[model samples]
Target: MEKLVIGLVQTHDDAEAAAERVIDCGYTRQEVSLLMTEATRDRCFPSPDVAPPSSTFGAAVAMSVVVPDLGFVVAGPLAAVVASAVGAGITGGLREILITAGVPRHWAERYQAGVRQGGILVSVFARSERDVGLLHLVLDDPHMTSFHTEAHRHHAYDTSF
Candidate 1:
């Protein structure tokens, strides 16, 4: 089985730092995803932003999907999924993308609002319970919070596939 987790950070610096920590922790960029608005995209991620090809998660090149109000950029595993959705002519926005990434609908909606307001949603996926626990340890710092408020105030978002 697979599982998903998310963490929310309020600053571009924090977001970038957390992403680097994920990489340093030995999770490849392919297993990580980032969600942020267009403005944040300009300020934060300025690279080619192409996710490295992965045999496990298919592959995704750069493709932009402009939703009505919030123009956001997606990278990593979810990028492949969103690219497929756009190819199929589905225009669902960030909320839908989060839900597809295994976030519960309620948390997805809240994370969407947070991203809209300039927070970054860092998503990660794992194939085992041990890996998920490792992610929680790597991410459960004071700076990041999941959507669950009180229960997750010191934890990242967690879900399973």
Candidate 2:
């Protein structure tokens, strides 16, 4: 069954490492997404003076987006969900994005608050139990608080971004 495996990390350093490991676990860059505040991105990420932007998050699927209501910086396939939320006329896109991705509304609210409070979200979509398990293992890595899933449902319609 297809699933969206997700977890939260307290620090940006942990977020970066966990995301790299997600890629190392054999999931395509296209399958991963990250959401954090712009402040978190600025504080944790290296400046352009140090190295090319793509090197930090990998070149294949790295992008920086600015979403209002919380100044979110979204990267990877989940950006599609944000766009869908916007296209649907919702404000404060993150919570809606999480819900539209099949997360329950209550959990989505908490996740939205979590991100606002400086937690980084790491998420991946997988169609196989193997891939989902691999993601769970990564999310259970050091510094991960816990993980959640929305299995076999694509509430966002087109999760292929």
Candidate 3:
């Protein structure tokens, strides 16, 4: 299983600087990818001076650094470096992102239990890798109806047994 340490840095409406920061933080070329999804461009990072402070003031850039073997240990400093570069605070932690990704509440709880039992909680985000890995699971699917339908079907099978 692959482990990813994700971080979001609110850029000063500058995607270039954000990308550079990700690289400067010791991320390999292959491990770090820029966040450029439509939903992210439209919602999380709208036009400059148009969005409220509650929303992103300018471009909101996110980067995912793929930790080869140990994600949990490296996540903290990785997040801090990204956040410091853009002067933005870190958002919720990994468990929060997992819950936001539509993982069932019970599943999250179970994972926590497993962690307590010395089991590593490796998570997989089912959406597009870039969207989930970079956007911090905030980008909602545009095709929600169909997505929910499929999710419901999958949930039914899981619960049936």
Tell me, by TM-score, which candidate is best. 2
Clashing pairs in 2: none
Q: Mind giving the per-residue lDDT tens digits that candidate 1 earns over 1-161?
A: 56776777776556656666777777875677776776866665443434322212213113433344438777676666666656666567877766665667887788788887777777677656666666665554465444336544333334432
Model 3 agreement with the true structure over 1-161: per-residue lDDT tens digits: 12332222333233334334444444433344333223334444446567555432232323233322222321222233333423433244334333443446654444334333333221222233343333333221223332122222222101110
lDDT of 1: 0.61
Please state the error at residue 144 of candidate 1 in Å: 4.7
TM-score of each: 0.69, 0.76, 0.25
Better of 2 and 3 by lDDT: 2
TM-score-best of 1 and 2: 2
User: RMSD of each candidate?
Assistant: 6.0, 4.7, 16.8
- Give residue 94's error in model 1 in angstroms: 1.3
RMSD of 3: 16.8
Across 5-33, the per-residue lDDT of candidate 2 in tens digits comes to 77777765576677778889877666667
Alpha carbon lDDT of each predicted model: 0.61, 0.67, 0.33
